[model samples]
Target: MEALLSQFSFLSSQALQDKNFDPTKIDDLMKFFELEAYNSWAAMETDLKKDVDEAEYTMKEAEDHLESVMDSAMDEFRRFEEELDRTLKDELDGLEQVANNAKKMGSSMENAATIATKKYMEAALVSATTTMKSAWKGLNFNSKKIHPS
Candidate 1:
């Protein structure tokens, strides 16, 4: 690069050395400089593209490795989830048997309490519906006004 720049500088100095340099000759010199600049730029751009392609290939290989790791992690997670589900089912069955035994022992008070709790929850839910609707409307209005598109 330094050698090419030095050669270009020498050429420019030689071009300027002529005492009675013709305008047409000067124009030709300018065209030569322009061509050289364009060719140099094209070569640099090609080298940059090659570097970019190599970088992209390296990134793709990394992505493939990441995907393989994620697949292995997912398989381990699935096995863990299956084991957890089996344990939960066994616990649930034991709880169900305990509840049946309690019911057989005439635990009618628990059933009544459960019904009352359900009724209270339903009433609270109904009462909050209008407030929730109004809040949602206000949020939507503010969001639309603040963010156009």
Candidate 2:
């Protein structure tokens, strides 16, 4: 919808730019349209004055309407920009939070792995110590029996 309005604004400006008037031709045309007579000058003067008055009124009305349209367009544009800014900011915040959560998850996984490795190493050491003590006791008993006299 905003795109359509912007396109309309562009086309309207283009139309204003393309409206080239030939003042000489226009003046000749206006003169040709004037009536001829003694009171014609007075009548022409009155008619021209009326035309001028009408043109002025029309110009003022058009200017006022254009001003109103421009004000509305400005307000809409400001609102659109603010909305876009807010949307982008929200998306950015969501991404940041996701990144933070991933980091925390990675750290927690690493801590769990370290603890498991430490516990496994401790259990292996205790099993090896027990096996070595049993082997020594068996060796001593065998030596004493063979040496008995």
Candidate 3:
């Protein structure tokens, strides 16, 4: 207030009037200062109100940004989860296919072994029969030579 008084020439011929100058009196220094002070106060109030309004706007913008970030984060999380699920399912399916292939291969190997064993037994039987027939022919020929019948 004193700074305002010093900056502006508060002392003048009108303010030189008596100390009991009527406040309601027009064209008086007291009335002019009173109006000036009210105007200054009103201007300060208006500036403060503008500041408050701007701060509210900034706060609302910040809240909106935070909400958007949260929504994006949730969406990203859902996508990651879905991707993980798909990878796991695909891996399980591959494993199942591998298991099935291994089972089929095992069965095929068993059948091949059985066929080889059957072939080996048949070949042994044929060899034994040929040997027996050759021995019988030799015995009959030797008996005819010894008896001369």
Candidate 4:
């Protein structure tokens, strides 16, 4: 029991540092951690149950041990839950940021395209107006021309 506790403690204490826990890696690590913790608790519970069945201790002692084991298991479970929650929150926040950035980029691109189209349209209008003015001038419309009514 002591050895099992020590092993669990050792594993729980092994924290990854200076590393990016991407989704895949984080998922894998969480799975392994969860498995180890669950196995440790299961082994402890099984052992205690066996002892109780074998009538190795007084009923009071068995109850106390069971309570102690439950408390320990709950503490471990809570720790794992909290860590998982934090990681999920972090990942969700990151995804939200990425979505926000994409939205901003799309808006920026739309603005740029609008501006470019406006400039091109203005240039085309000016060119057409100039060409029409020149064509009218070449016809000398201002010059007098006799016409039968």
Best by lDDT: 1
Q: Would you estimate the TM-scores of all the predictions?
A: 0.48, 0.56, 0.52, 0.53
Query: Candidate 3 lDDT, tens digit per residue, 30-143?
Result: 566678899999999999999999999999999999999999999999999999999999999999999999999999999999999999999899989999988987676545
Residue 26, model 3, lDDT? 38
Superposed on all Cα atoms, the candidates' RMSDs to the truth, in angstroms, are 33.0, 22.2, 6.9, 33.2
Off by over 4 Å in 1: 1-19, 93-149
- List residue ranges in candidate 2 displaced over 4 A: 1-38, 131-149
Higher lDDT: candidate 1 or 3?
1
Tens-digit per-residue lDDT, 100-127, candidate 1: 9888765677778889999999999988
> What C-alpha root-mean-square deviation, in Å, does candidate 1 show against the real structure?
33.0
Q: Model 4, range 1-149, lDDT digits (tens) per residue?
A: 45555654554455343244345644565677678789989999999899877785577787999999999999999999999999999999999999999999999999999999999999999999999999988897687987879
Error of 1 at 96 (Å): 5.6
The deviation in Å at residue 62 for candidate 4 is 1.6
Model 4 residue runs over 4 Å out of place are: 1-57, 142-149
Indicate whether candidate 1 or candidate 3 has the larger TM-score: 3
